[model samples]
Target: MLNKFLDEVCSHIRCKMAHNDIRAELTAHIEEMQSAGKPIDEAIAAMGDCAEIGAKLDKQHKPLIEWPLIGLTAVIVIIGGIMAFTNDYVMNHSGSDFMRFLLFAVLGITAAAFFMFFNYTKLRDFTWIIYGAVWVIFIGSLIMGTRGNVSYVFLNWIFIAIPLLVAFAGFMDKLRGKGMNGLIISTLLALVSLIPAVLTARRAVIFLLVPFFIMLLAAVYKRHFGVNIKSQKAFLYSGLALTGLLVILSVIRNPYRFARMTDFITNVPEGNAWLISALRDAISSANWIGGADIVYSYAPSVAVPNLMADFALANVIITFGWLAGIVLVAAIIALIVRMFMITRKVKHDFGYYISLAACVMLSMQFVISVLMNLGMFPFMGVSLPFVSHGGTGYAANMVLVGLILSVWRRNNIIGKVPRENKNIQPLVEYADGKNNI
Candidate 1:
């Protein structure tokens, strides 16, 4: 009995000691016991009851609240507050912009907190309902939504509604087998919602499709490739087919997409010199920390800096400068890499699919944003994540991060299911072949 107890205690100690310091101290005590002429088991027994040690170790390693994501939320909130104040300051001290910012910020924080605390399994089962609701709200917006002269359809309610819907749908999918379906539905809904926007020449809506395209492409890739594609010719063909479709669509809708196809194509100056000059000046001023005040300033009679749709990239470059541009790109790349890592580590199909969806979303956003900035594409007016000053875009991005964090938390809690009723069957199980009748 003593030997058994000592062995259990030693094992507990090994499992709990994550650092070298603890290991060294424990080893020294074991050595001292041996030098005192006690046998190994007897020496271990002399160390006293392990109940206290076991409890201590458990306390040490117990999961605390995730801090990194909390820190990110804090940073976002702070930056958002500053942006709101600046916007208000610029708008003759009217608090309307700040109020809008607060509304979006509060919604985003609430959604994030819910995702962090809710049981993922419950969310997963309701994926379809959430998916359907997004489209319903979107179509309803078309009927009741206010129209803007610049864009065909402007649904303020739907703008807020869709992100909340997507966040919930994403949550459900992340917790269940049909999670990929949620992504697919979300992508389809996003595309469908943009139809009116596109018809009205709302170029801002076009950028929303970038994420949809990426999600669709990833889904096709996974479906065709299965678990491993290296040995499968069918998967290779499927990948080619999907890529071909995307290319065809791009060419049909936006022929300018092919301008960058050939390396020899050159930029046309085409009377845009003044616009380019202004952009350059703005960027130079910002680089020296003196441009924010002037960038938004327009002569009372002159238009508010509306250039060609292709000038969006120039706007970013001019507004933020080269250094900030590089940092933005690096941060986006890091997010993509991290998402991929999480996808790889997840054992559940739901978690894997959700992670992949997020990966596609972030990756596509980065690529399109960079492409637009470089004048390789038209300016679609999509706000850059974490830097742009739009309420809807900021809220949508916050929900995206919340979903990703939820998945990360779920993955970390693997093999650590919350205590449940013993009478309930496991939610999932694998066959062990021992119950043959």
Candidate 2:
């Protein structure tokens, strides 16, 4: 009967790492009871049934798949493909671009589902590997030359780097426990990402950089960086103030950038008014529903230069009119907001950061794209995540969506430790020496 109890447990338990420890713990519990004057049979009987307990633990360890959330996002992206279908370039170019959008959209959703349903926590192991791969891309891009056409790897590194930033939050959590070295260690870890951003030299890198800092600061503010929350926040506000000052400095230092900034603001240069004027004319022509002839005839240049990329939203508003644009923008804002709401369910610091990072990245790009179209900001060619027609952009965006979904599905759940089996017990019948029913 003594041997039978361990055998039943060993057979039911799946994670081999915990097997021996569980065995030792259970044996000690029985021996402790025996030493307290109970007989072996009575002591073992006190432990109860192993099978019932094992089943409960099994449920806790299993990965959950949130089908409704996954399906909603999948459908949203596909619905976004609607914008691509009606665009001037999409229709005239034999629909090849739209086809690419569909293919990559599917690929992205599939990749995300694969990651989502799997053990996402295992990704913490390769956080640095993701960081290293992005660094490799940055270095390779430099050697290959950033001019002319960009490579696939280089273009998608932003998406890859964002996930690494999310995972890095867990590393920060460890350092927070380390005292003074914790802040230094976490700062160095952040530099891994900044090196690549500086090398790329794309002002647009702000799309990725902002969230990394926001989330890193948020995590650190929550004590993931070993500093008091108030201290980290003071530093965060100081950094923001400094960033604004530098932007002002940058515009002052660079003649061309400043000229564009000034022209965008006041339209002082009649020459640059064409860009802003074109956007206004396009929007104005769409009298709630759209006067397609007016936009094509009066504001052709606005949609022509980057119709399907940076200006996809402009195309949607023009073609489909005000209601369509409002609905699409609302949907995107809702998606980001929903992501934040989901983060509340995530217990781990890294999971919270990943979900929030994706939301911030998507939100920043959307806001910037709209601002760029309206001539409020210089054109940075940032694509609207789901709406943009680029393959790499769409695929990367979908994957991030999946990552958010993965965080939600697996929130606070450990990969291998079954909740029910956490406390195994000796079968009461066997423990009582009544081996048979």
TM-score of each: 0.56, 0.78
Query: When superposed on Cα atoms, how far off is each prediction in RMSD?
Result: 10.3, 6.5
Q: Candidate 2's residue-wise lDDT over 1-437, tens digit each?
A: 65577667656655443345455557767778878999988876777787865555445444556665565565457656776665436334334656767777778777776767655566667777766766675677667875432344545655656656655765764454464456556655765566655554455356656876777566665665554666666766776698789889988999887776667677553665566666666666775775455665544444445666777777777777777777776776666667777766776665677777777776787788877765677656687777775657677776676777787766534322222333545444234443231
* lDDT of every predicted structure (CA atoms): 0.49, 0.64
The TM-score that candidate 2 achieves is 0.78
Q: Write the per-residue lDDT of candidate 1 for residues 270-308, one digit (tens) a residue.
A: 244333334444545555232244556752112225321
- Model 1 local distance difference test score: 0.49
Runs in model 1 deviating more than 4 A are: 1-66, 69-99, 135-233, 236-281, 284-286, 292-340, 370-376, 414-437
